[model samples]
Target chain A: MARVARGDRAAFAEVFRHFAPRVKAYLVKSGAVPALAEDCMQDVMATVWRKAAQFDPARASLAAWIFTIARNRRIDLLRRERRPEAEDLAWGPQAAPEAAEALALQQDAARLARALSDLPEAQRQVIVQAYFGDLSHAQIAARTGLPLGTIKSRTKLALDRLRHAMGRE
Target chain B: MTPRPAPRHHPDAALLMAHAAGTLPEAFSLVVATHVSLCDTCRVELAAHEETGGALLEMMAEGGSGRHEAAMDQDGVLEKVLERAQALPEAAPPAPPAPGTDLPEPLAAYVGGGMDAIPWRRVGGGIRQAVLETGPDASARLLYIPGGRAVPDHGHRGLELTLVLSGAFSDSEDRFGPGDLELATPELEHTPVAEPGAPCICLAATDAPLRFTGLLPRLAQRLMGI
Candidate 1:
């Protein structure tokens, strides 16, 4: 990402190439149009090029860095349902950019993935079903035959353990 | 001595799982973003979610379905980008606004900019929303329409939490001022009205969108246009 901060077009291009499809996949899964997904994909990549310098490793990994960007982009787009605001997605005046932290982010992503995969299957399933399957808590309760309180408690504890395992304080 | 009470409720398991799986509604996602901004416990949960998402992406790739993680595209993307860069013009990008001219701290810390400077749209009278903002620290932020108005009565399909930052609002249960945090389960129901003469300014983060009650209220909400 630092390569991005230094106006490295090649690095910026690399960021785009890697994230675009997944961004597209994410948007599509999130119910985005192919066209809208493409558009948001463009926006996400544009941010990478423009705000590459803001990637901070001490605090976040590159995947987390980019995920945050994607999350904000998704939010900006959704808020549009309520109001049509400006297009302030520029390389603007306020940026605590983390462009130099890509390598660290990559390392973090690897560690994080391992930690998540290592979680107890039951706890991991609860997280996956709720998130990937988009199940409501009541629905999860009904589906698993677990009490609502138990499901909730299990999910929270699972997440807590996952976070600790990931080494994020 | 015991540690100070955490300023905000961390995003619980359901919310984190939903976020990791990318199934969280946008409205709720905004609220979650606000919470993660104020709480570290939630951030750790988020880190785990990202990790989970990364592994799923990797597995898909190894199987040859071609999804190289949510934000990282290793094979095809790298090649395409390399080609795109060689043809671009030369010149390093400029630094961000020089020191002393930076955006105000909280706003900068939140969406990385001040409120007045954000691009806002009027959602209704005295109501405007800036949607989603990426914070300096990689958290998410949103610009709520302020200057006093009611928070349309609603409940979540999941737990919802809000952290007051600049103003006040009250639900059937309590009144909340700046720095105060409110946590509501899916079962709670109430109307959120702005305090008279002062618009409620809050930094809200949630795990799902509102499931506004009743057909009449839902219809009325649609009619009110927000």
Candidate 2:
């Protein structure tokens, strides 16, 4: 990222080679078709190259930042495809998180990963569908054959536990 | 239930999860993003969700091969990015607003300037509102109510998200100060009254017109198109 921020072409190439496929796969797993996922991957890489200046290692890990960009871009792209009239407010300039809080989050990725895997199967399944499969609670309820209230409660409980275990208590 | 602290009054985990998933409507996303900009707790939780997403991506055993050979550049995407980066004009980020104005970051772009600059129109009973058009199926607005005043008693026809931006207000739910988001559903009915000491300002979004019980307010609501 330091090299890419400095406009090192070789570094940029390395980043694309490493992250593009994974980003595309993330999108695909989240429900984007292959072609759309590839398109999003390219866009995500382009954003990475452009916003490299804003990447502060103290605020977020490289993977987190890259995936954040990818996830946001996926939402924007999907919204446009579904409702072209609906403009994207998500990508617009907003408050940067407090440096201290971001620093805390930056250190907790590994712990969070472990916590997620430790979640109960039902809780983890709902989260997986919500975060990666792009499924809303109602949709998850439909797909999983659970009641809407049950799905919402599962999600709330899962997040409560994850936030607690991640030490954001 | 005891009134939870401001951090406790966040948007539901379901809403945040939908935001992480990128499936929330733009109007609702605007409210959530603005609330997030103001709330550290939500920011940390959102970051955790993003990290979970990153972990899931990394955990995938089989990385799919390129199926869009034609759409993908035969040469490389890096070249295209570099070229585009060079071609693009430099973005000069706007100067940050001075602290304590109580304006959240996400709402700044829509306001063009600060809160004082907004062209607020009188709705009725010392309440003023500036409706923000955030695409379809929803409506967002900046509402200003004098201290000790109350909005009309009403029930939601659809979802209504009322996020207190400055000062405080108490509804049927509880007291909400700056950065607190109250999700008012159709089944609930309440009147939000500004707390004493200072005028309460809030960013409120609704999917459908509020169902006002009084005939006069309903007529006035029609006149105001709120």
* Top candidate when judged by lDDT against the true structure: 2
What is the per-residue lDDT of model 2 for residues A73-164, given as tens digits with 9 covering 90 to 100? 87667655221111112434556556786566566877777888899999988887887777666678888899999988888898888889
Over the stretch B59-133, how does candidate 1's per-residue lDDT look in tens digits?
A: 222222333363354445445444444444443554333245223233344354655555656555566555454
> Whole-model Cα lDDT per candidate?
0.57, 0.74
Pairs with backbone N, CA or C atoms under 3 Å apart (clashes), candidate 2: none
* Separate clash counts for every candidate: 24, 0
Q: Show model 1 residue runs off by greater than 4 Å.
A: A4-50, A70-110, A129-154, A167-169, B1-13, B16-23, B34-162, B166-177, B189-226
Error of 2 at B189 (Å): 1.2
Best by the DockQ measure: 2
Q: Which parts of model 2 have CA positions greater than 4 angstroms off?
A: A29-33, A81-107, B1-8, B60-75, B91-102, B196-198, B224-226
Query: What digit string (tens of lDDT, one per residue) describes model 2 on residues B1-226?
Result: 1123545588877777676566666677778888887666787666566677776665554445644663365346667666766655664443444454435556765776578777799987888998875667578889999999998888988888988878899987899887789999889999999998799999888878889989987986886676
- Candidate 2 A-chain TM-score: 0.76
Q: After superposition, how far is residue B7 of candidate 1 from its true place, in Å?
A: 2.7
